[model samples]
Target: MKAVGVVVEYNPFHNGHLYHLRESVKKSNADIVIAVMSGYFLQRGEPALVSKWERTKMALQGGVDLVVELPYAFATQKAETFANGAVSILDALHCSYLCFGSETGDIAPFLHTNEFLQKESEQYEEYIKHFMQTGVNYPTALSLAYQKISNRKDTLDLSQPNNILGFHYVKAISKLNSNMIPLTIKRYKAGYHDKDFASTSIASATSIRNSLFDQNADISSYVPNDTYTILEKYKEQYGVFHQWENYFSFLKYSLLTMKEEELKSIYEVEEGLENRVLKLIIDSHCFQDFMEQLKTKRYTWTRLQRLCMHILTRTSKQEMNLINQHETSPYIRLLGMSERGQEYLRSIKKNLKLPIISKVSGFHHPLFEIDLRAAATYFMIFPEPLRSRLLKTEYTTPPIRMSY
Candidate 1:
């Protein structure tokens, strides 16, 4: 069976995502489209606006043939590390292509840029160090280094979120030298950071989440009917939509109570950030305000948010280092699947490079433990009734299987 892979968060799967999934299948001409989706938390260093199970159901309903978990270690990291884990999984699955939505739409530039960076690694590193000495953020430093090394004006565009991630996907593929082809689908309607929900059929997930959680605006037109229904169910049961803001008090408590040494032990905590967090926790009123007080050129809001989340979950550097030592996912944990997806899994089950985890009881890895903690963390803010029912241990909750 030919399978095309996508690395996604789905975070509630809006209309734009539905469009991309259909286009990916059409463009790849594959039998199955496998999605490796983030669990609980997202790459931007924030909790998802909805549960992963709900999002997985949305993906299956929308168009994904199969879905697998992208472990928390990689899911919450920077773009490069996130892409590395995702590409590695797809390569292990022996997918034919990797398709992703991008602002540029064209794949030529990403390929060219990846090749250039690979060929000039030493020079690029030197430039990066030089720029870092100026106290700019790593992304800014990397962007400046790329423009310097490539000596192309357009190379600066690599800094855009989608473009940056797409470039990393290509780079990871090249690094692995896997057979999978890389492709891009042009993003439509709203831009990645565009917070306004337009009247168009598609809107960014950011806009939809903001509308649902912040303004309580109607987002029926921006998402599929099934998605709307699922969201409404969550709303009635859980009050407002689940978001990072909902966990602010927990995060603040974690921050205020954690020792400096303990804070330093968490992943992404560095450069005396532990000290800064301890100092600022007292003055901050909420998550948004805490983030504002801590934001700086050296630390992006996304980076700080991720750090705060790590502290809340007690995700330690030692744990992540152990994962790196292992070099790949311990198992492929199925999230949800359609009929064709089931067939695809069966076809590859015999020759799989990693263990297939259909039952959570079989998991003996620390990474899976982290995943469980993350899920539990997500439910802490949920209303009691919904929280009780929804907080089933991973062992008890089977993957969502959709029959025709």
Candidate 2:
């Protein structure tokens, strides 16, 4: 069975994601579309509004054939590292292609750019380094470097989140030179952060999420009928993200109470970001305000989010180095799979080199418990009735509950 792979967060599955999942398999002409998904904490350095299990079920029911966990280490990282982690998993899955949604649907130019960067264009590297040293943001640095290297007058907009991630995917696939083909589907939404959902049938997840909590907009129009029904069942149970401010305070306290050197240990704290964080978090009122205070032109909000995630995950410098050395997701942990996914897994599981671990705790590895402990952090922050249930939510969290 030929399988196409997608790297996703599906933070809460929505129509746009469903569109991409369907399009990926259709475009690849593959029997299954396997997704390497983010866990409890997303890349944005925030707790998933909904549980990962819920998201996985939504993906399986919506379109994806299989869902596997993308380690938090890779999931909450810079674009390059994120792509690397996702791509590495796909490579191990023996997938025939890697697919993603992009603002510029045209794959030719992206492929062209990917090939160009592969030669280690001296001018590009120099241009990028120069911009970085200026403390210009990463997105801006890339745009500047692209202009210098391509010498093309076309305005390369790296500002859009999808485009930036798409570029990283292209770079990663090119760098690895793996067997997987690269595929892109046009993103249905105009922008990643558009808070307004138009009635155009395809709405961004951000817009759907915003409308869900917004007092005015009708969110039922944005989600699938099934999702709409499910959400209604759980709506009252949900907490506004802002309600979790006290949790962030707990985290800040956890940090400040620790030794100065201990604060420096988390992943992405390489240049003393932790030290800056200590002074910064105190002056700022809320978590968002604290993050805003720490933001830099050189560091994208996404990068800072990862920094926050690194601290939350307790990822030490040693762990970061260990992960970097591996250069690929260590294991393919199956969260859930549909009939087609099972067939695909059976077909490719033999050819894949990495271990495919289904049960999280049964596995006697140190990493298994560590990931679960991190997942527990999710429960601790949201003190809902679900927290009791989450304590029992193990690696054995069954084949997802799906409602057609």
Candidate 3:
């Protein structure tokens, strides 16, 4: 009953994801696969194409034995924090291995990179600080710093998105001293940010999402049958797929009503960003326009979007600070599980490091409360009857049980 864990968002489980899942199972040689998935929102600071529940069904149908929700505090943060939370949960679950999709595809490079960085941590920090002070974004600063110290061809290229995340996954495992062995699978044809369909069958999630929104394009060929079915079902029931533009009006309202001091209290709102948002919010007509005006060399679009998402959900800096005071995730929240997954959990339940949450009624952690607020805010984009119904599901919907 060995288990392999993967940190995923499954924005809408597609062919590339299916390939990764299958490949992970083969590579890890484990009996079951467990996924730590994002809820409501994604790491890029965008709302998920569908809710977590629907995505859970997709995961189960696509072959994941278990699915756990990545708390909002970690899911929407940068790569380092996101990996720390996700990897810790897998370790808590007592997974034997962690499998991730990366550009490098070789586990050796990630190990080498982590070890090199650890030995050169002081010099790396100095280089990062020097780069950041020159007006480059954080990701850019990291890439520059890595290049400055490590010229070895065997190390991962930090500039690639999946490679960056995979490196952090390795770093987190070492930091926690977890027993899980790390594995990697090369990503399929399409790139992470690919906007158009690059392959006939192996399209990126970004391309699939863009097609879905741009023309209501049929994505059946790009995803598994169950994933396609779930996508259609979600859109049919919710009337529209979730996206940032859908919540633009509400975001505008939030910015309009909140005072400068209040906006400044939100997480990631720093360095006079509150004032800049206050001044620009009124003149902007849409989310894209507002972002364009607010975008600066120092702030990446992803970072800015995350800031806006925090403002929209009223996620205060104090709340995040309180949650961060703890070393790892406060709890492991189950979203779905198969028969094998249930059996595995039962075996490990006694030895589990974190409490496993099947229902939210008795839970009272600050991180859990942020997840609740995020759920509430996410459903606000819907019309009245639908909004109330969807919001109620946040508490009422139990972890999905599946047989296969």
Candidate 4:
């Protein structure tokens, strides 16, 4: 049986995501679809709008066969590392194809570009160093390198978020030498960063989230009925959505109390950034203000946010680097699954390479500890019932299994 894999951060699953899931199944002609998704924290180094449980339920409700947690170490990382973790999990699960939504809606150029980048590694490196010395950021430097080395500017348009991620996904597949074929579906309606809701069935997750944050606004037009219902239910009971500003005080407290040596040890803290962060934390008011104060040519907003997250969670660079060298993902933790997904898992149970974790006690790893700490930090912003309920150890939380 053929299976298609998708890497996602549902944030809150909406109509556009539903469209991608359905279209991916048709495009891959797969018997099952597996989604590797982020947990509470996201790639941009911010808390998710809702809990992972709610997001996983949204995925299963939207027709995903299986949903697995992308570990904290990799989920909240740069594009390449994020792709590597997701691709490694899917490849180990024996997925036949990797399906993703891209603004360009074509996979051929990404493939060709990946090959070119690999073939011109030395030249790319030289160009990257040269651009870095000129004070350009890492991503921009890499893009400049690609243009100089490949002379195929059209193949590497880093301005488009989906295109940038697609390139990294293909690169990760090649690095693993995995047999997964890459496929892309044209993104519909809104762009990744589009904040305004479009008058269409498919709206960007960003728009849907922004609407949800406003108490009086309606978002039914942007999301599936089940997703809307889930948000409504949570909004009534435990307060559903959150932005980084909600947790800024705790992060500020963390920074103020953190030692200079400890701050320096956190992942992504470089070039005496610990000292800069210490000085800036005193003057910054909100999360946005803090990010603005820290942003420079060397560090993008996203990179700075990631650094903030590391400080908040107290994740040391030593621990993260050591974990990455030792394991791609030590175990696959099931988050949610439909009946069909469970059936697929049953069929592959004996032949699987990585351990399928439905319970927390199934595996013990240092990375999992980091995930727990991250979850604790995320849940601190939530209300009492939810905060207490979700703060349980990984072993205690059962995977959400549903017939839908």
Candidate 5:
């Protein structure tokens, strides 16, 4: 009855993701797999190509036994906080192992790097800040500094996206002294940020979303038929991120109209990123553009995006800290579950510590509450039928697309 946990944002289930899930199950010899996924927004600081429930259903159909929501606050955060949030949830669930897709797929290197960094990390941190003062991007500064201190100049580019996120997972596990063993699956194909579906079977969510937006390029190959059917039903209904311009403007106005001191309450606002955000909100054409304008050497895009999302959700530093002190994940909310998943839940229901929620309004999690509302709000932006149906949609979310 051992469970393997995976933290994901299956914006749209794809072939590569399916491979990862299957490999994870086989590698871990897991009886059941639990995936803690982002609700509505993705890590890229944009609305998911599809809704959370849709993605949850896709996960279930795709092979994951159970799908749980990673609260919005964590899902849209920087790598460190994001990993912390996901790992904490998996640990809380008493999962025995974690298996994530990685470019290196070798845990030994990450483990070695983790030990070295842990034993001698203060110097690296100092070096990173020194580079930051020179106007290097935070991630680049971190990479450059780590290389200098570790004396692995040519080999220590751990800052590449997946590896960076992986490092955080390792760091968190070590810092927390958790027993969950970590494993990595070699990524099969398609780079994460790759914007086009180069192959018929393997593609990134970015590519699929791009297809959906372009109104051309057959997406029949990228997603499962079920997903296609779902997309067809709401193709015209879902408002793409581009359409969220008005919404972003609303957010900008909200920030600018607020008192200066009030802006300081938002997380990631230190050193006046808030003032920068407020000033540029009007100058930029869209959310992405706005972030570009606000990004600085001291703050990375991922970090700035997290800050922007926090602002949109009104997650204050005090509130975030208060919530963090009380609950990393207050309750494990099941988005969808297969029959096997249902059985697993039954077995762990009594032994588990946190409450499991299956509905939105029942949650008091500040971030969850906001994201759920935002999800509905975003759905409402879509035209008539979808807007109306998805507004109060519950389990109507269909099964995941796993039949690749």
Candidate 6:
């Protein structure tokens, strides 16, 4: 059985995702689809609308044959790190192809862009440093650097979010010397950051999430029935969908109680950012207000949000640095698998590079410990028995098996 891999967050698994999944299968002509999903926190440094397990059910029901957790260390980082971690996992699983949604939809541009960047790697770094020194943000610096060096009209636009990730995915595959063929499907109607329901059926996850949180809008038409049902069940059982604003009070508490030195130790807390946060945190009322006060030209909202997430979870620079020393994750955390997925894994089990972790009972690794802490922090918003119950599930639950 051949398998194609996809990197996803599946915050709520909507129509766009369904389209991508089905299209990936058709384009790759693979027997099964495997997804490496983010756990708790997402790439933009916000809590998932639902938990990982719930999202896994959505993935399975949506047609993914297998689901694995992308450790927090990788999930919350920038596109490069996130892509490296996810692609490495797929390569470790011996996948035949990696398919992603992109703005260009053409795989050749991603390949060409990556090759161009590789040839001018040193010059690209110099350009980025020069741009950053002029007060532009990292993303802006990257775009400027790429524009400065990229002479080919066929190269992808690095400014677009999905395009940036696609470029990085292709880059990672080359860096790892993996044989996985890269493929892409053009994103549907809504853009990555679109916040309104522009399309009748296809809507961005951001738009869906905003609608849900802003007015309890019905998103049944945008997502699959299974996704909608799971989301409703999660909200009913947990009292509210998870979001950054939900944890603002706790974040404020953390900011208030921690010493300056302690805050400085957190990952991404650099260049006197700890001082800015410590000074601004006292006067801010909510997460939004705090971010507004702290936002600077050099620090993007996504970057600051990731820093805040690291601080909220008490992740330190030392820990992140130690983990970065490794090229890939030590273990492949199996979140869920279908019958076909199970059979495929069995076929390749002996030749696998990483251990597949089905249970967390005695799993011991520095990186895994960070994942555990991230889960605990994610569950901290819930009250009493529910909080304890969810945390306990993290350790006790086995891989979700789908019979169909």
Off by more than 4 A, model 3: none
Model 5's alpha-carbon lDDT is 0.74
Weakest 10 consecutive residues, lDDT, candidate 3? 321-330
Clashing pairs in 4: 360-395
lDDT of 1 by residue, 221-325 (tens): 989998999888867766767667789889888877778888889999998888888998898877888888899988788888888889889999999997667
Q: Give the clash count for model 3.
A: 0
Candidate lDDT (C-alpha), each = 0.85, 0.74, 0.93, 0.87, 0.74, 0.93
lDDT of 5 at 247: 58
Q: Model 3, residue 182: displacement in angstroms?
A: 0.3
Worst 10 residues of 5 by lDDT: 395-404
Measure candidate 3: CA RMSD.
0.9
Q: Which stretches of candidate 5 lie over 4 Å from their true place?
A: 152-156, 236-246, 283-285, 288-292, 323-327, 360-368, 371-373, 380-391, 394-404
lDDT of 5 at 297: 63
Better of 1 and 6 by TM-score: 6
Q: What tens digits encode model 5's per-residue C-alpha lDDT throughout 173-257?
A: 7776788898888777788788987787888877877776787677777777766766676555553533345357657767778
Sliding window of 10 residues with minimal summed lDDT for model 4: 150-159
TM-scores for every candidate against the unseen true structure: 0.96, 0.91, 0.99, 0.96, 0.87, 0.99
Off by over 4 Å in 1: 152-156, 383-388
Q: After TM-score superposition, what is the CA distance of residue 377 in candidate 4 from its true location, in Å?
A: 1.0
What clash count goes with each model? 0, 0, 0, 1, 3, 0
Winner by TM-score between candidate 6 and candidate 5: 6
Against the hidden true structure, what lDDT does model 3 obtain?
Answer: 0.93
Per-residue C-alpha lDDT of model 2 across residues 166-205, encoded as one tens digit per residue: 8788777777778888898988754677877655776776
lDDT of predicted model 6 = 0.93
Query: Which tens-of-lDDT digit does each residue in 234-268 have in candidate 6?
Result: 87878888889988998999999999999989999
